[model samples]
Target: MPLPDLVRRWQPGWGRCRTLPAATEVPGGLRVVLGLPGRHAEIFALDDQAVPALAERVAEAAEPTWLTVPTTRPGEVHIALENADLEPFPDAERLMTIELDDHPAHPVPNAYWAKTSEFRGVHRIDLTGHDGTVAASGLAAIVGTDAVMHDIRTDPAHRRRGLASAVMSALAVTATQLGATTALLVATTEGEHLYTRLGWEPVATMLTATAPMSALVRT
Candidate 1:
C-alpha cells in the first residue's frame, strides 16, 4: 500500500478515538460519517460492511445542497459534506517521518517549546548555525500506536538559511530509527514546498468548517 493509504487506514483506529457527535460506519468497502448536523457529512471506505440504514439516516438529516465528497481516491476513502461550500483543504505536500514506538531517553532541546505545557511527550531536534544559537527545530510525538510531527519552525532571523531542512532531517532520521513508518502533519503552502523537496508527498486535501462556542451555547 502507498504511504498515504497506510497512514489514512491507521488514523481513527490507532490515533485519537473520541465519541464525536458524528458517527462512523463501513458498508460495501466504504467508510462513512453519519449524523453530522451541519451543512456537511464525511465519508471514507477502508473495509467491507453493510450500512444502508446509517446512510439513510444521514441522507434524511442532510440539507438541500448537493453532497460534497472530498477523497484521495474515488469510492475508496472520502469525506462527505452537506450544505457546505467547497473550499480547498489545507495540506502540506511533502513527506515527513512517522515514528510508531520511539521513546527518546534524551530530553527535548528547544527552550521556547519547553515553556509550553503541551510540549511534553514530544521529541525534538535543534539546528544550529556556525554561531551555535538554535536556528530551527522539529518536534514529533511517537506514541504506541500513532505518530505525529508538529511545529517545524525556524527563528525569524534565520529564515532561508536551511535550518528548517536540517532540523527536519534530524527529526526524520530519529523517527526512522525509532520504528515509525509514517509521519503526519497539516502543512502550510510554503512548508509544503519544502517538504516535497525533502521527499514528502501530498496524499489528500482536507476541508474544515468551524462553529463558534457562542453559537453552540443557547443565547
Candidate 2:
C-alpha cells in the first residue's frame, strides 16, 4: 500500500530484511540490508526520530554503512540530505510505483519485442527498430512476489514513438508469468510523466546514500 513497504517487497534473497524494532509494528521502521558485505543499506518506515539511533547503531556495526531511507532523514549525512539537484539521478523526488492489469494495449510490430538476455532472475528486453538499432530497453527483476521494472530508456531519436510503453507492456506480461503481483520503480521527471500516462502513480519520494571515502577508508 505505502511506497516503502512496496519497495521492501521487491528486495529478495538478502541476509537481513526485517523491521528495526519489531515486525509486528510498522509505520516507518524497516531495515533491508546484507550488512558487512553489503554495498549499501536501505531502510524504510524510518521516521526522522529513529535516524540518530539508527546512525549510532550503524557506526558500531561490522563496518561502515551507507543508509538510504525514503525520507530525507539522514543517517549517512549530518542533516537531512535530499539530492534536489539530482546528482546521479538527474530527476529528484519522483519515485513511483506501478502495476499493470495484464498487458497494456499499444500495438507495436511483433518484430520489436525481443528478449535480449536474463541473468540472476532479472529479464532484459529490447525494442529494435528497422535499422536493427536498440530503440528502447527495459528490465524486470522478479524477487519473491514483487517485480521491479528498472532502467527503461529510449534512444533520443526514437522518442515520442511509444517504444518505452511497448517495453513496459512486454515486461508487465513477463512479470505476471513470474507470479509477481506488484511492480515498483523510481522515476525521473521525464519518466514520471510518461509512466503516469501509461498508468503508474507517484507513490513516494526516494533518498539514497553511500559511504563517503573517509568512512570507506576508516579502520
Candidate 3:
C-alpha cells in the first residue's frame, strides 16, 4: 500500500527535527534544509511532487542528517543518518492499533522502573509471568497537544496472545481520560494489519534516513 497523506504532511521542527543549528533555503523548486553535524553538515530537500529528484540532489549535495519518506514514493532512494537509523514501513497487515481520548485512571500493570530503561509515563497494563518475569510493556508521551505512543513491545514467546492488544486498548482509554483527542504512533509491518483491524488507520509510511559524519565530512 502507499504512504498515507497525513503521514506525508507530518514534518519535524527544530526541537523535534533531531538535527539542529541548521538552515533551510529554497533554490528553484527545491527547498534545501541543512543541519550542522559537528564539523560537517547534512542536507535534505522537500518537494511534494519532485520528491524523487529532490532526494537525489540532496543525497549528492550533502548527506542527509535525517529523513523520512511516505510509502507513496517507494521508488525513491534514501540514505541513513548518523546517531540514528531509519525505520522501514510496516506491512499493511498484522498491526493492532487504536487511539483514545482520555487517560486511564487505573494503575498501570507491569509498572517498574530501571536506571537505563526508556519506558516512561503510566502504562495501562503489564504482561508479566510467574516468578516476576516481565513478558511485555507499553509507553506513552505528551508531545505538545498530541499524545504520542512511544514504544509497545511484547515477548516473542508470547506471540499470538492478546497481551499487546490489551495494552494498546488500555493506553487508548487512558489517553482519552487525560484529554487527548487523538493518539499517534508508528507500527512495524508485523503490527500494521492488527492496527488497521482495530480501527487505527494507516496515516503514513515513515522513512528514517540518516547521514554519518564520514558521509558529511567527505561531502
Off by over 4 Å in 2: 2-4, 13-48, 54-66, 72-79, 82-91, 109-113, 209-219
Select the stronger candidate by lDDT from 1 and 2.
2
Question: Could you give candidate 3's per-residue lDDT for residues 1-219 as a string of tens digits?
Answer: 222323322222221323333244443121324445532333333433444444444455444433344443444433322112332222221212234533232333444321112233333345576556666666655344445564567888766666667666666665565666666666677667656656776644544343333332212
Could you give the candidate ranking by TM-score, starting with the highest?
Answer: 2, 3, 1
| lDDT per residue (tens digit) for residues 24-120 in model 1 | 4434223334333443444432321212333343345434111222235423322322122232223313323333233223333443222212244
lDDT of residue 190 for candidate 2: 74
- By lDDT, rank the candidates, best first: 2, 1, 3
Q: What do the candidate models score in CA lDDT, each in turn?
A: 0.45, 0.58, 0.44
Deviation from native of the Cα of residue 90 in model 3, angstroms? 10
Model 1 score (lDDT): 0.45
User: Backbone clash tally for model 2?
Assistant: 3
Per residue, candidate 2 scores C-alpha lDDT tens digits across 49-108 of 555555444444455354445543323333433222111122244556666563466656
| TM-score for predicted model 2 compared with the true structure | 0.65
Q: Positional deviation of 80 in candidate 2, in angstroms? A: 3.5
Which prediction has more favorable TM-score, 1 or 3? 3
10 residues in a row with least lDDT, candidate 3: 88-97
